[model samples]
Structures are given as structure tokens and as C-alpha cells.
Target: MPDFSFDRLRRHPDVEAENLFAVDASDRLILDEAAADLAAAGPGEVVVLEDHYGALTLGAAALHGARGIRTHQDGLSGEQALARNAAESGLAEAYRSLPLGEELLAGARVVLLQLPRSLSALDELADAVRRFASPHVRVFAGGRIKHMTIAMNEVLGRHFGELQVSPARQKSRVLIASAPLPVTDAPAWPRVARHDDLAPGLSLTVCAHGAAFAGTTIDIGTRFLLEFLDRMKPDAGSAIDLGCGTGVLAAALARRRPGLRLIATDQSAAAVASARATMEANGVTDRVRVVRDDALGSRPDASAELIVLNPPFHIGSSVHAGIALKLFEDAARVLRPGGELWTVWNTHLGYRPALTRIVGPTHQVARNAKFTVTVSTR
Candidate 1:
């Protein structure tokens, strides 16, 4: 049996909390179920997708001696954590990160996957595999049974002819699929949606990739934040949409203040892509710049005149505040003196105290039953 030690694993570079962990039962189940296929595959033939913090990648390399493993992770934190974990575990060069397309999936055999919760993400992955992978490739997709749905099977079935469900173990189950089916055409993504009710004559085009938060629609927190757009300093030369999911905030800012240069940044590759598309769709591509980065780490200290955020309350699936706090700290570092950080968060998170300590003096902008919007002056 391979050494599957959770005690030795860590979520370094990803948000960590008392209750959050790097590996899960599903990770082990996927690896265990795909052991035979993984062992038989030659170098560069095995592909791993969404391997949280190197568990699937490192485990495959270290335990099964699987080499030249090509892997893809949507989040920057997860990618960084995987690198750190690989180095710490003496498997630094075992796997390389690649985009989810022809290059990553143009393989000879087996794939170990951690099924994404988003059905759209699943559709994208399945489409890519069917379009790129070898005809005989077998995919072992596993997840917690509680998180699985019939839709996942249907999504896989659309691309693969054969599907087999593995017996549940440790509350996890793996879906094995093979025989790639040909598709006449690939589906269009970065789907667009229009928000006409935000403001009179202010119909906005929102775009989103499958993995983007809230998809193409504006979430309540963001919609609430947008209500106060008129309150932002008009003359501010540059503004940042920190943790921008689909560039909605940045696009709105650009649309409202054509003179302002807006930076839209998020850690998720999918989010960044969606944000860029949103900017383009809304005719703000020239004014809004979309980037994939860890919080505001890519910006220079004291560089931004204004930063707006609708921070996430969770790290992966866990309801933890570490991620929001980290973003708050980054916003603090990036905002200039006299600049402002406008934030919207779940009211229960009670981020005002942390905002005061991290950014500067804070004042409540708006609050309702669910969310609180606060502005912190630096």
C-alpha cells in the first residue's frame, strides 16, 4: 500500500484554518482506484486536474513513481501550495503545471480527476478531454459522494461512451469513463448575461467562465457595492477591483468614470479570463486591466488610490475568514495614504474591526439583512 499520510500534508500558500485541510478522502480514493492505470502509463501519459495542494500529483509521483505528470489547478493559491508541497516532499520536479487544453490532454492514457462541484466546469473539462485526449483514454473522476450529482454523470456521458461507478469508500466515490465520443462543435464559454436593472440606461454585459464565482450574474454583495458607485472619489487616477471575479466592478467603475484606469485582479485563472471577457463585452477593455494574482500581491505598495472588494468568506469549501483577512492585509499594503478601500462582506463576518486594524479608520457605508459595506480610509 502507498503511504497516504494526511499528517504530513499542509495547505501552505492556500488559506489554512483550524478546520481546513489539504487532502481529503476523495483524493485518496481517486488515487487508489486509478492505481493500476497510473502504474501502467508511461512518462507524460498521466494527467491530474484540480489536485488540491499536490496531494494527487505528489502522491502519484512519490507512491506510484508516475513521472512527467501534467497537472492543472484553477486557483493560484492551490498551484503555489502544490509547488511548496512538492519541494517539501522531495518530489519537486515530478509534475509540471499546464493549461487545460490540447497540450495538457494530448496524452496516451489515464487521467485522475477531482470532480469540480460546478457542472459548467465539469462540462468544460469533459469537452476538453474529449476534444484533445487520445481516443482510448480512461478518466477516473472522484469526489465526496455528498457533493456528487446525477448531472456530473450526464456531463461525462456527453463526452465518453462508457461510464462505471466505483463503490463508495470513506464517503467518496469514483466515476470511471472511457471511449471518447466525437462532438460536432465545442460549446461556447465565458457565457454572457446582461444586468439591466442596476441603473437606468445602465445595462451592463457580464461575462463568466465556468469556474468564476457567481457566474455571469452580479451577486447580491456586488450589487450592493455597486449601489454606492457614485460615492467613490471621481478624480482618483487609478482604482482596483481586488479579487475581481468577473470584472463587473472594474467594468462598472470604468463605465461610470471613463477617465479612471481600473485594475481587475483575482487569483483564479478562470476568474481572470472571465473578467477580461467581461471588460471586452462591456466596452471597457481599454480602461480595465484584468490580472490573475494572489490578492493584491502584484501591485506596488501604496500604488492604488482606491480598492474595492466583495471578499470571499470561504477558503475552498470551508467557511473560514483567513482568506478575507489576507486580502484585507494586501489591500492595506497597496492603498496609498488618503486612499480608500471599499469592501462588502457577509454581515456575520464582522470585518469592520479587522478593516480598521488592517487598512485604517473604517465607517459603515451600508448594511442590510445579509451584507455590510464598509469604507476604510488609508
Candidate 2:
């Protein structure tokens, strides 16, 4: 093994804190378990999925002499972190980033995956591998033991004929699967569903790719926030759906105000794809533009008149307020003076003070049993 250093990895462009880390034991264990396959594989044979940083891809390249790695990361932040780490480590040429499709999986012989928490995501990835990757491909999927469940094995088994469980090391474990099953059915991802009861006389068709948050269903926080949609700045010519997952809010807004220009943006590639599909399903494609961005990073400062948000309270599995606070600061920077930021969050998060400090003059809009909706004006 080469003397490669995982310690050099950092979660830049994502939330960084004492508890959050770019690399984890699961990453190390995945690399360790897949070392022989990576070393024996030919060029363009290794693929990494949902790598939190460049750890797995870089580790395979630097430590095992693997080359031509193709990787897919759902979060734009993760992709950015991996790119930065790859460049800094001088392994930028070893791998290329691609979407989760046939181009990324075709002819792949070895796949190292940091198992996603969502079974739907794993199912989609496994199905893609079965349908597109080489028949001899071996998938080494690992995650923290606490997050891994028996259902993950069941999900992978649906696509692969063989499944092997590795012994736990450092509270992490890897599941080895091979022998891709024949795929006869059409791809099941980007699932669509109709919600007629979001509001009276308001029906929404939500579409979600496998990795999208809430997955074709509306979360309580967003549902609470939507209650006050009519009360939003009525005269505002344009509006933004910050962190718009599935574009539910943006579609509703576009329907409510036919003349208002709308933008729906999220960092997750899956979310962006799903939101675009949702917008199209609702016949709002021309009125609402979907973008994959990191917390309105592409928006100009003081450019937005109204923004609707249901910011995530957790970064990865670790519950942290940093991600929400980062969005708050970005929303503040993007909102013009007197612009409104309507937000809904868990009652326990207590984001009012932060909103007041970051945006300005935060006022409670509504409160349900578990959620609190607030409108902050800049």
C-alpha cells in the first residue's frame, strides 16, 4: 500500500465543525475491502458512488494505483470537496465526475460506495449497476454500523445475485455484492406522485429521483410553510425557492401567481433533477427555472425580493445547526433591503434568534405542533 494520507482530506465548501469529518472509518474500510479488486482492475474499471469527499476515489488512485476512476456524488458540496481534495493531492487526473447513469457505470468492474441512508438511493444505484456495469463487477458498499440496516442488503439483493457481509471494523462494515441480475423492467427512479390535498383547490404533482429528500412526499415543515404562501410579498415580481426539494413550493407559487417569475434551487443533483421534473409535471417549466446550487451561491447579492426556504437542520447524519445558519447568512446576503425570507423549521431548532440576527426583524408566521414558520425581512 502506498503511504497515502487520509488526514489531508477536508470538507471545504460544506459544513465544517469539530464533529463533522470529510473522511470516516467507513471510507477507510471500503477502500481496504476493495483494495485487491482496485489493484487488479484495468484502467476505467473503478467507480465510486456517493463518496463524501475524494477519500475513496483518491485512495484507490493513490494507494492502489487505480486509474480512470468515474465517480458520482449527489451533493454539489461533496463534488466540490472531492475536486478540491483531488487537485490538492495531485490526483486530479485519476478520476472524472459523471452523473449517475450508464456513462458512469458502463464497463465498471469495481465499485466502492459509501452507502446512502436512503434505501431508495441504494436501490437506484444498484439497479443502475445491474443494468449498465460489466457482468463481473463487484460492489463494495460500506457505512457506519448504526446507519446500516438489514433492509440495505435486501435492496442490493434485488439487483445482485450474490451478497457477502464483511466483519465489522471500527463500527463500520462493508457489504460485497456481485453477479448482476438481469434487468427487464424500466428504471424506477424519478418516481412521480400526485398530491391533491396540500391546500384546498390546490393539487401538486411531485416527482423525485431516488436520492431526493422526502422522495415524492412533502415534509411537515414545508407543508407548514406553504400555509402562508398567499401572505408572502404579493407584489414581488420574482421569488426563489431556496433549498427547493422536488420544487413543491416553487410549483405552488407559480400556480398561485401566474405572472411571478420563479426559481427553484437545491444543492443535490437528484433534487435538482426531481424539481425540474416536478416543475414540468405541473406545467410551470417556463415560469419556474430549476438550478443546482449551493444555498443560492449563484444569486447576486441583494437581488432577490422574496425567498422561501425549508432549510435542512442536519449536515449528513449528524444533526448540526451550521448548515441552516449558512443558508440563513446566504439568504440574508441575497435578499434586498425589505425583501422577505419565509422559513419553516423544527420547533426545537429555535432558528428565530439566528434569523433575526442574520436577516433582520424576524416575525413568527405560524406554529403547529412540531414546526414553526417565521418570516424574516431584510
Candidate 3:
């Protein structure tokens, strides 16, 4: 452990609160477990994946003397936070951000990963490491103990020949994997699934990359929200899908209303990729534009006529309303006067009041035992 201060790290450009943090025990444990390998590796031979904020990448660079590091973060917010932290720490030259592809992993001898909660995401990451990285690459993946499961080891085992479990420390643990297995088949990401039952005479070809939320399946909340597709302002010419995952809602809207223009946007790289693929698969690419954005951050204020959202309630793993509220505020900013913001949420969250205060007068459109769909005027 060098003198680098994890305490100095901040999760700016992300929803921040007393409970949400930029670094965690798992980050420190991962760096400590890989310190020897990181120090031994040459410059440009280190790669960091799924680093939430700058902990793993910056720690490896500033603390372990690793340089020319390649990093990939699924979330745009995390990527921005890393850049800000790197500049503030005067280590901006140590690492570069890249996509989750061969360029990021090529010839890499050491990899530090912050384990994702999705098994499909882990599988895709492990497969890429084995397929693209150096044969001798050593992967150190860490996560909180409560979020770790035996299934994760199995996912890694499918891509690596050896797996070593480190002793848990401070309720965190790491998995060391080496001996990359030969990949024979095509990459298994951007999975495609078709649904004909969503609505009568309406079928969706949903595509999802591994890290995309809800994978290729339509979540119950989104499905519930889609029930009101006909009820959305019929004369609206354009719409934005805020936090769009897999472009399910966007594709559905495009299919139902052939003349309407659609924009699907999300912060996650995987989600943006998945949404683009989905739009293309559904033959809606001409009418739908998919973008990687942080909650309509790139959209002009008072430009959108209608917006659809299924805002996430969690910031990272903790249940919080800050993220949802932030989305609401952004939606309010983007929607034109008298425009509509239709959203779906968990019934228990009781977001109607927040929606009313942030967007405009809100009214529930529909509610089931589990989810509630609402419409707010802007």
C-alpha cells in the first residue's frame, strides 16, 4: 500500500449521499491482492475493468507505479468521475479509458475488476479477457462478500483454467483467475430475444449486451408502462426514452407510431450498444436514434415533447431515491411546457409527490400490486 488516499476520491457527476461512496473496502482489498503483480508488470500491460469511480485504476497507477493503464467503465458517470479524480490527483497521464474490447485488453498482463452483480456481465468480461488479453494475464476481481456468490466462480471458470479464492477481509473478497481458456465460439453478448405477446399484433426484437440492465428481457415495470402506450399524447411528434435499457420502450413506441421520431439514451456503454442493436434489429433505426447520455444530459432544455422513463431506484447497490429524483429533475428540464413525462416505478416507492413537485402536476395512470405508472405535465 503506497500513500495514495482513497479518502480524496469523490463520486461527483453521480448521485451522491451520505450512504453512497466512491470507494469501498473491496477496492482496497483488490489493490492489495494485486499489488505484487501490478508492480511487476510493465507500463501499458495493466488493464482495469468496471472500476466504480477511480479507485482501482488510480490506485494501481499512483500507488503501485503502474502506467499507461487501459480502463473501461460501463457507466458514463463513472468514466467522468475517474477523469476528474485523475486530474485532481495529478495522475491524469497514467491511464486512458477504452471500450470493453480487444484494444483495452490486448497484451495486458494484469487486470483489476470490480465484480458486477450480473452473472451475464461477468461472463462477457471473463470471455473477453481470455479471448483478447495476453495468455499469461492474471485477473484480480473483487467485490463485497454479500454480493459474491458461487455462481460468479463458475462464470469465471468457464473462461479460465485456474481460480484462486482469497481470504475475506472487512466483508470483502477477491477471486484470482489465470490460464485463459481458448474461445471457440462467437462472442455471446448483445443477446437477442423476440416477444410477440407484449401487445396484440406488436412484437419486439429486444437486444441486450451483458451489462445492460434487465438483460434482453423486458422488466415488469417497463411492461406495465407499455400498457399505456396508446394513452401517451398521440399528437406528439418526437419522444425521448430516458435511461433507456435495451430500447424496449423506444422500439415499442416506434413500432406503434410509425411516423414518430424516437431517441433512446442511457449512461451505460453496454446499454447504449444494446439499444442501438435493438433498434436495428427491429428495423426502427431509421426512425430511432440511440445515444449514450447521462440522463438526457446532452438533450436541449425544453426540446423534448414527450419523455418515457423507468428510473432506477438504486445508486449502485444501495436502495436510494436520489437517482430517481435526479432523473425527474432532468426530465423536467428537458420537457417543453405542457409536454408529458410518463414514468413507471415500484408502487412502494411512492414517487407521485416527488414527480408532482419536480416535474408538474402528476397523476397515476395505472397501478398494479407491484408497480405504478404515472403521467406528469411539464
Local accuracy of candidate 3 as per-residue lDDT tens digits, 1-378: 334579999999998888899999999999999999999999999999999999999999888999999999999999999999988888888999999999999999999999999999999999999999999999999999999999999999999999999999999999999999987999888899999879667889999989999998899999898888878988999999999989999999999999899999999999999999999999999999999888888999999999999999888899999989989999999999999999999999999999999999999998899999999998
lDDT of 2 by residue, 144-230 (tens): 999999999999999999999999999999999999998889999899999988876688999999999999999888888777878
**Clashes in model 2: which pairs?**
338-378
C-alpha lDDT (0 to 100) for residue 131 of candidate 1: 86
* lDDT tens readout by residue for model 1, 210-236: 888899878999888988887886669
Per-prediction TM-score: 0.96, 0.98, 0.98
Which regions of candidate 2 deviate over 4 angstroms?
1-4
Candidate 3 has a TM-score of 0.98
Clashes of each: 0, 1, 0
Tell me how candidate 1 scores on lDDT.
Answer: 0.88
Segments in model 3 whose C-alpha atoms lie over 4 Å from true places: 1-4
Global lDDT of each candidate: 0.88, 0.94, 0.94
